[model samples]
Target chain A: MKILVSIKRVVDYQIRPRPAQDGLDVELTNVKMSINPFDENAVEGAVRLKEAGVASEVVVVAVGTAANQDVLRHALAMGADRAILIETPAVVQPLTAAKYLQAIVQREAPDLVLTGKQAIDDDAAETAQMLAGLLNWPQAMFASSIQLADGRATVVREIDGGQETLSLQLPAVISVDLRLNEPRFIKLPALMMAKKKPIETLPAADFSVSAPVLTVLQIAEPPARKPGKILNNVAELVAALRAEKVLP
Target chain B: MSVLVIAELDSHGIKAATRSAICAASQLGEDVHLLVTGNDVAGIALEATKIAGVSKVLHADALAYAHGLAENLAPLLVQLAVNYSALVAAATSFGKNVLPRAAALLDVAMVSEVIQIINATTFVRPMYAGNINATVVAPAGLRILTIRPTVFEAVAATGGAAALETLTATAESGQTTWLSRDLVQLDRPELATARVVISGGRSLGSAEGFKSTLTPLADVLGAAIGATRAAVDAGMAPNDSQVGQTGTVVAPELYMAFGVSGAAQHVGGIKDSKVIVAVNIDADAPIFQVADYGLVADLFTVIPELEAALKAE
Candidate 1:
């Protein structure tokens, strides 16, 4: 089975991003960048599938500028067999990203597609479901566990109340949550090997890229909490909580 | 312009988050219609009709919708999208799962986890795990949105007399099938909507430690229990109990943390709480920055003392 996985380059999850000076968008200039945390899980899942013999090949894809090759290289070091970059300088919204992925899915004809549940940058969590809709493929979102066999994939999904298990036909889309697996650490040997590998590049103009539908009006910091007081004892804390009507 | 609010359900009736979504829908436009779809969910639709701002409730009951699988449910939304100006739902797992597919099928843009409705076209939503809030203007066509439930007050549940409309057409994408469900049955209130929450960190070494340390305090306060991702990762708590950027984002009336270092990811989820109190041995723990009250002490000793004090009172 050929598995295709999508990864995104975003501001590192550890770094707190601030709004730009002009307040039009988040400040991305000179900030630390890394693979989105969940997408790393996606790449890890795909690599594990190949190692387990369920997948014959794993191809990792990203949609960004030349800089996205960094994340592609990171995926390669994790054992993805090939990399493809859909080069675009513009900020690709979820639907437009899905359209690009749809074009790739048609070209690759992979049996399964994997993606991070959501990107930390936008926190939109829309691409995989949108891709599934555009491709007319079944999707299992927020998958915590997955088993592939007999042209069907059984997935355990994390839900609000509990876990729900579903079986989807092969050639489906699966967006993974955090609990799926801890991504393997990239070692020096694999990193060195990945650096030498060539990445296939395709211009975003080649695909049926649609016009942007959403416009950013402004970006600002969320409301801040009031400064708190440090209590010296449990009794003082309890008394203060009661007076504030925070304790019953 | 009419707005369609998708109602989420459990075994009992309409979920609380769906009520909040209805409240958000009412803010967007005057005509608010709710769609309740599931197997034998007519009762839920009837419950929806009683919500103050809802003008109509659409009920679609069928076995194919029992699980509310996105494959089948998205097509149903696609069928209904033409008549509505916007489709709205709570940004819970169910809404996050179903609405995006419907939006894509209709080839429209969606703004998820909306915290404020700036106007009919503009919205405010958090990005980078609540660090930054972005105000976005959606396309002029059909708008798709999911409201962050905790930010909006629920509409009154017993005021309106909305007409119940039964929908017969069913859309089933046969590519996916539901198999089973494993839900953690909690005896206490749900973490998302509880008035108070008591959460712990990895300092509780084991699952046994996690339960013993927090359960009594939770019982005394009548609050729900939650955990940091570190605790869940360490197996001290169940995955469902995780409260962080990657886990359940809660906005309870009061949130209490014990031995939590207050990482950004963890704070991202709890920043919306009305009152936050943290207890930790480390005085400089980051959780104190966002907390309304901070105490430097051993959580093990603090837990017992606090529980006993509340019990005595």
Candidate 2:
């Protein structure tokens, strides 16, 4: 089985991003960036499948500007066989990203596609299912555990209330969730070696880019909550909660 | 223009989040239609018809949709999308799974996790894990959206008497097959819809500590149990019990956190809770910043005392 995993570069999870001065988007000037946490899990899962001899090749893809190559390299350092960066400076929406990925899937002809359940940046969580839809393939979203065998993938998905298992034929997309697996740390040697690995760059213009269906009108900070008070002890806490009528 | 809202269903009937979806759809326009698809969802369809502001209910009953697989449900949604100006659903797991696929098939962009419906084409949603709110405007065509149930108020359940329409089951795509499910049987309310939620973090130590320390308080208050990502990662809580950006975003009346450090990811999920109470040994835990009330103490001792105090009442 050949697995293709998709990743994105986003503001580090540790950073509590504030809106930009124009109130149009988050401040991304000189902030620490990293691979989306869920995508890291996806990469780690795909790598593990290859390490287990179940997957023959693992290819990683990202859709963004050249800066996204950093995330693709990180995936390479984690044991992806090759990397593809679809270069575009435009704000790639989910549908656009899905279209770009569909082109990649058609070219690579991988048996499975792996992606993060949602990106930490947009939190859209749409690309994988959209890709599945466009390709008329099946999708398993929020997969906590995935097992591949006999041209089928059994995925344990995280639903609202509990977990549901789904078995999909090959050429399916699986969006990985947290608790899937801990991403392996990149060693100094692997990082050094990954720096030399060639990444294939494809211009977004090469493929027909559709007009954006949705445009961001504005972005602003949500109203902040009022500063809360600290009680002296648990008794005071209970009294305050009761006074607030939150506790029956 | 009319809006079509997909109903989120459980084993019983229409889920509470679907009611909130209806409320969001009603904001879009007057003609708010609902689609309920499942194996045995006649009762669920009937329940959907009673939701206030809904004008019609489209029920699709088939074994293919029994598990609500996106492969089977998305196509039916595409077939039904032509009549409405927009498609809407609560951003639950089901909605999150099905809507984008349908949107892709329709060749339109989807605005997900919407918190506000500014107009028929514009919406307000959170990005970067709820730190930044972005207002998005879609082109003048069919729009797809998934609204955050926590942000929208659920419409009343017993008001309108909408007409019911049955839809023929879409053919099985044969690309995916339903397997087994392992759902945690909860004695208390589900976390997202619960009136009160009691969450713990890594300091809970082990799965035993979560059960022994938190269950009593949850039982006393009739609250659902929640956990921080650290606690869930530590195996102290199930994956579904995790309350965070990646886990579950909850907006309960009262949210109590024991030993939670409140990382940005976790805080994003709970920021919508009406009253947040945090108890932790560390005085400077980030959770205290967003909490409505804070107490600096060890949770192991405080949980039992708080439970006793509530039980005494």
Candidate 3:
């Protein structure tokens, strides 16, 4: 079976995000960019499928600017057989991204597609399912474990109360949760080898998908929490709590 | 102006977050319609109808909805979206997953994890891990929103005469099928949907400590146990149990912090709770700012005493 994993280039999760001066969106200048953590899980899951001899080929595909080449390279260094970059400057919404991916899936005709359950930036958590809807494919989102055999896949999803196990047919889309697998780092030697690997670049306009229907009007920073005050002793704190009806 | 509130139900019954969403829906004028889609969810619809101010309850019962997969439910929601001015769902995993897809299908923007309904078209939502609050106005006509359950109080169950209407939908079997379910059946209350939450931070030391010290206290109070991202990263708790900017956002009636030096991310998730009480050795911990009650004492000593006091009560 062939595997295709969707990756996104997002602002580094570690940095403190600040709103732009226009108060319309996050300021991205000088901010470090990396492959979204969830996408990393997806990439890692695809690599595992290859290691387990379940997948014949693993292709890592990313949709973003030319600068996202670094992120696609990272995936290639990890273990993907090849990389595809669909270059676009526009901020693609989940539906638009899903439509574009549907076109890609039609071209590639991969049996399995993997992606992160949600991107940290938008926290939309809908792309994989939306793609599944657009393609009428089965989806196992927030999948903690995946077992493939007999043209069917058994996936364990981490739900709100507990874990739910689902069986899906081949040619399905699965979104990886954090607990699915710990992503591996690329060694310097592997990084050097990745430079020699081939990356196919496709312009977003080449896809028949249209512009996003919804537009982001503005992005603003949340209110800052007030600094805490120190209490002298436990008794005083208890008294204060009782007075405030918190500890009564 | 009618509001459509999506009702969430599990095996246990109606989720508390859905109750909160119902309350939020009540605030948007009087014509509040509750939409329920699931197998054997008639009981859930019956219970939702009891909540005050609910005008109608719509049930789309089908076997395909047994798992409540977003792929299948999004289209059903789009069909219902035409009648209501705004759509509301709880910010639980199910709501977060399906609402966006529904919004996308409707070709409209979604305002997620909303804390307040500013008006018909505008709402207040937290962005950047709750670091910044964004007040947004949805495009005119219809608005799609997901409410953080903790922000609103549950509407009182006054046993209103809510009219129940059954709607049929074409079953779209996706690539997936539910095989089995393994729920971590906790005797204690749920954390995100609980009225009271007692959370421990990295200062608890280890998972053993959390099990020994925090679990007992939580069990006695019938409260949900929560942990900071530090504790989760330290492997003391699973990532799903973590409460922070990236994790679950909860606003229980009462939130108790133990040995937690409230990081901005952690505070952002729980700051909406009605009352906060902090128990930490360091008096200057950032958690005390939002905490209604602050205790400067070692949790090792204070937790046992607090548990005993609660037990005595």
Candidate 4:
């Protein structure tokens, strides 16, 4: 069985992204970038599945510019056998992303696909579900636990107020949650070995998908939080809250 | 243009988040209908009708919806979506899972996790992990929205008597079948809806320390407990207890972070919290920048004394 994992390059969560000077996009020039935290989890999930003998090969896919190859290499170092990058410098929305993913899914025909619940950058949390819809495959989101048996995968999803477990047939899409697995650091040797892995780059324009549906009117910083006063003691903290009527 | 609000429910009735979604839907269009799907959601359907501004409730009673699986929900919503100009739900987990699938099938763009409704075809949503606020405008097609309920007050559940309608459309739950559930049922309020939250960080030292130190303060304040990603990564706290960019996003009336030197990711989650209180031994923790109240003290000693002081009150 082949497992396809999708990864994205996002600003490191530790580094705050500043809005670009145009006020229509986030400044990405020279920003610290890393594999999206959840996508890192996706790579780990796929690697573990391959390790447990559930998967014969793991292919990591990214749907962005050539720069995305950087993230795909990280996925390779994490144990994916091969990588594919859809070289599109254009802004890729979820729908556009799903189309590119669908193209890759058709080509790979993997038994299962793993991706982050949401890309921390867009926070759209929509690509995997859209891909599932396009492929007409079963989808499980926010999966905390996944077990494979008898050509089916059972996933425990972190839902509102609780977790729900379900078993779905093969060729399904599952989005990884935060607690799925802790990704291991890539050893220097593994990073060097990843240089030999095959990485196929496809032009994003090759896929005939619908154009982006949403138009960006403006991008600005979210309202700034007000600066606060430091309380003298615990009593002062309680008293200040009481004075503000936030506490009774 | 009519709107359909997807209703999420518990054993008691419709959830507060769904109620807030209904309110957001009411603002989007005039005829707002609610669809309640579950194995035995007749009572919940009735509850949905009484929610203010709901003109009607569509009940899809079946075993398939017992767990809110997207496999069943997406097709079901697509079938009923023809009459509605827009589809909406809270940006909660259920909405995040189901709506995109339906939107994809319909070949429409989904306006995700919006904080404000600009118009029928426009909205403002946070992007870049709450760092940038972007105003998005979509075409005149069916607008799919997942609203953050905390940004909008939930509509009252009483003072309405809308009619309830049952749908005869069949739905396939796909190959996915409900197996089991692991729920965090606590005596205290859920962190998502909690009015007050007391969170700890890596300085809590260990899981045992996280529990023992925070439980008393949580109990005394009648607040839900939370943790920083640092603590979660350290195995000092559970994943669900984590509040950060990767974990659950929360905005409560009062938020108190103990020993939490806030990282941008953790602070990203709690930015919407009305009043933030930061307590740390370090005089210049990053958390103090966003804190409405900063306290420099040893949490180990101060928390216990604070609990006693509140108890004395």
Candidate 5:
């Protein structure tokens, strides 16, 4: 089976995010960038499938600027057999990204495609399922675990309450959940080998996808949290809750 | 203009969050129709019809829709999209999974986890894990959106005239088939859906500590158990049990934090709660900022006493 893993370079989750001075976008001047944490899980899942001999080859695809090559390299170091970069200067919306990816899927024809449940930056969490719909393929979103046997893929999805297991035919799309696996680190030797690997770069315009339908009007900071009142004791707190009619 | 709201149902009728989404939908327009897609969901459809603003209930009951897979539901929704001016659903796992696909197929913009509908054209949604709120405008047409149910109150069913519509579409599209479902049966209330929640942080120490100290208190109060990212990362609770920016966002009537030093990421999850109470050893924990009531005491000592008090109540 050929596996395709989609990755994105996003603002680091640890740092506080601020809107750009233009007030239309996020300030990315000096912000630390890394593979989206959820995407790392997707790559790790693909790597595991390859290691288990379930996949014949694993390809990592990223859609962004030249800076995203570093992210593709990281995926290569982690165990992807090849890398493809769909270069675009501006950040693409989830729908546009899904369209671009669907075009790539048509060309690559991978039996399985894995992507993060959502990118940390946009938090849209729509790409994988949208791509599946665009391709007219079956999809299992937020998959915590996956197993392949007898030409079918069994996916364990993380739902609101617990888990639900589903089986899909080959050539299905899946989005990885946080509990899928602990992503492996890139060792020095693998990093050096990754530098020697081949990377094919393509432009987003090459794909016949339309512009994004939604437009971001403005970005602003969320409402500030109210200052907390300090109580002397648990009795005081409980009394206050009762007074507020929350504890009745 | 008619607005279409998808009511998500489990084995137990319509979900509370779906009711909240319907309430949000009512805010959008006067003519609101609800679509309940599942097997043997006629009772759920009937219950949904009783909500004050719902004008009709559309049922798409079939074995194929039992799991409500995106591939199956998206097409069904796309077919229905042409009839309505706006489409809305709860921003749950099901909505997040399917709505975007439906939107893409209709070639329309979709706003996810919307906190407020500024109008028919604009919406407010959290970005960067609630650190930023982006007010977006969709290019005018049939607008699709997923409402964060926690942001709105579920409007009570106040007897409304409802018409039932049965939709049938033959499509062999969903590549996935449900094999089995393993629901974690908990005697405790569901954290996200609960009216009251008691959450613990890393200061509680271990999973054993939480199970022994906090769980009993929560059980007594008839509240759901929640955990901060610190506690979840420490493996003190399952990922599903976590409540934070990265985890489930819950808004309850009463929220109690035990030993939780509120990080911005963690606070975002509970900001919508009607009343928040924080208990910590440190008087200056950030949790106090958003908390309506605060207590300065070691949770180890206070929790047991609180449990006893609730038991006495």
Candidate 6:
């Protein structure tokens, strides 16, 4: 069995972003970029599956600009056997990304496709399911644990009030959640080896993007959150909460 | 153009979030109908008709949709999409799982986690973990939406007498099979409904620390328990206990945070909380800026002190 992991380069989880002057996007100048934290978990999951001998090979794929390859390289260092970058200059929405990924999936034909439930940037949490729909495959989304067996993948997923386990046929899509795995750091030797790995690139112009679209009208800092004064000790904090009447 | 709202019930019967989704649907300038899919749930559907702004109830009475499995229900929604201009559901796990699939089948984009309905076709939503809010426009076609209910006031559950319409069960999609579920049955107040909430972070170190330190405080205050995504990721809390962009969005009257250095993802979930009190050793933790009362002290040191103070009172 082979596994494909989708990677995305997003604004670092820690950066508090402000809307750009264009009023349609976030300010990118000096903003840090990194592999989406959940995508890192997806990579770790694929690596673990390979290590457990359930997966024959792991391919990391991403759809974005040249800078996104850095994210793919990070995945390669983590353990994916190869990388694919569908080079696109467009701001790929969830539906469009899913379409591009579907194109790649048709070519790769991996037994399982794994990706983050949502990216920190768009936070759509829509791509994997969309890809599953386009591919006509079952999706066990927000998977916390996955096990491969006779032509089936059993996924333990996180839901609102509890956890549910679902079994899907092979060649399905699974979206990784936060508790799926702790992503490992890239080692020095692995970093050197990843540089030598093969990375295939495809131009986005080859595929017509999906329609039924959305347009961002404006993006502004959510009316500034009032910064409360920092109190020195617990006594002051308690006194304040009492004064505010949340506590007696 | 009519709006169809998908409603999910809690063990206690219908929840306020569903009512809020109906309230949101009503604002879209269209006839609002709600879909309730579950086994042996027609009685609940009858009860559901009392919610304000719900003009009709579309009940899919079947065992297959009891769990709201995305496989079986997504197709059902797609088949029913012909009559409706917009399909709306509260941005819970059920909405997250089903709407995207329905939208994909329709070959349309689903505008998700929407906080405000600017008009019929436009919306305001928080992105980049609530640090920035974006106004988005859905083009001409089916408009699919998953409403973030915390931002909308729930309409009254009594007022309207809506007629119940039974929907036929579509051909079952046998692609995925449900196995079992491990549910967290907490007797305490639920995070979304609780007046007071006590949340923890990864700095709690381990599940043992979380249970020992946070549970007592929660028990004493009769507050719900919530966790930052970091704590849930670290296995310090259950997945359902998570509060963030991907987790439970909570806005209790009093939301107390311990050992949580507020990351943007976690902050996104707590914006609705009325009075935020944060206790962290790191004075510069971003949570301090959003908190109403910020204490720069170790959680271990202050939590016990505060617990003692509350107990003495």
TM-score winner, 4 or 5: 4
Candidate 1 vs 2: which has more lDDT: 1
Across B113-219, the per-residue lDDT of candidate 3 in tens digits comes to: 77888667677777656766667777687777788877788777666778989899756756567788877777777667777888999989999998799988887
Q: What is the lDDT of residue B18 in candidate 4?
A: 90
> Tens digit of lDDT per residue, candidate 1, span A1-248?
99999999999988878889999888889998999999999999999999998999999999888899889999999999899999998668899899999999999999999999999999999999999999999999999999999999999999987899999998899999998999999999999999877799999988767845689989999888999999988889889888888886
The residue ranges of model 1 lying beyond 4 angstroms of the native Cα positions read: none
Q: Write the per-residue lDDT of candidate 2 for residues A1-248, one digit (tens) a residue.
A: 89999998999998989888887778889999999999999999999999999999999999998999899999999999999999998558889999999999999999999999999999999999999999898899999899998999999998877889999998899999977899999999999998888799999999986745677789888888999999888789988888888875
Q: Output the TM-score of candidate 6.
A: 0.94
Residue pairs with backbone overlap in model 2: none
Clashing pairs in 4: none
DockQ of every candidate: 0.81, 0.80, 0.41, 0.78, 0.69, 0.68
Chain A only TM-scores, each candidate in turn: 0.97, 0.97, 0.96, 0.97, 0.96, 0.93
Candidate 5: segments with Cα more than 4 A from true spot: B282-285, B308-313
Lowest lDDT sum, 10 consecutive residues, model 6 chain A, at A205-214
- Tens-digit per-residue lDDT, B101-197, candidate 5: 8888887768899998888788899988787889898888888889998787887765776888888854757577888888889888888888899
Model 5, position A245, has a per-residue lDDT of: 81
lDDT of each: 0.91, 0.90, 0.80, 0.88, 0.86, 0.87
The C-alpha stretches of model 2 lying farther than 4 A from their native spots are none
Poorest 10 consecutive residues by lDDT, candidate 6 chain B = B8-17
Which residue pairs in candidate 5 collide? A228-B288, A228-B289
lDDT of 1 by residue, B48-69 (tens): 7888888899999988889889
Per residue, candidate 6 scores C-alpha lDDT tens digits across B1-313 of 6899988876677777788888889889999999998888988999988888888899988878877788788888988899999999988877888899888888888899898998999999878878788899998778999998877889898888888899888866777888988877888987877889999998999999998999888887888999988888678897788887778778787999998888888888888788999999898898898898888888999888888888888
Identify the runs in model 6 with alpha carbons over 4 angstroms from their true place: A230-245, B202-209, B229-240, B297-305, B308-313
Looking at model 4 chain B, report the run of 10 residues with the lowest lDDT sum.
B168-177
Q: State chain A's TM-score for model 6.
A: 0.93
Write model 5 residue lDDT over A1-248, tens digit each, in one string. 99999999999878778999988889999889999999999999999999999999999999888889988999999999999999998778888888888888999999999999989888888889888888888889899999998878999998889888989988899998888998997899999999998899998778777845677888888777566678776667667777878764
Candidate 3 lDDT: 0.80
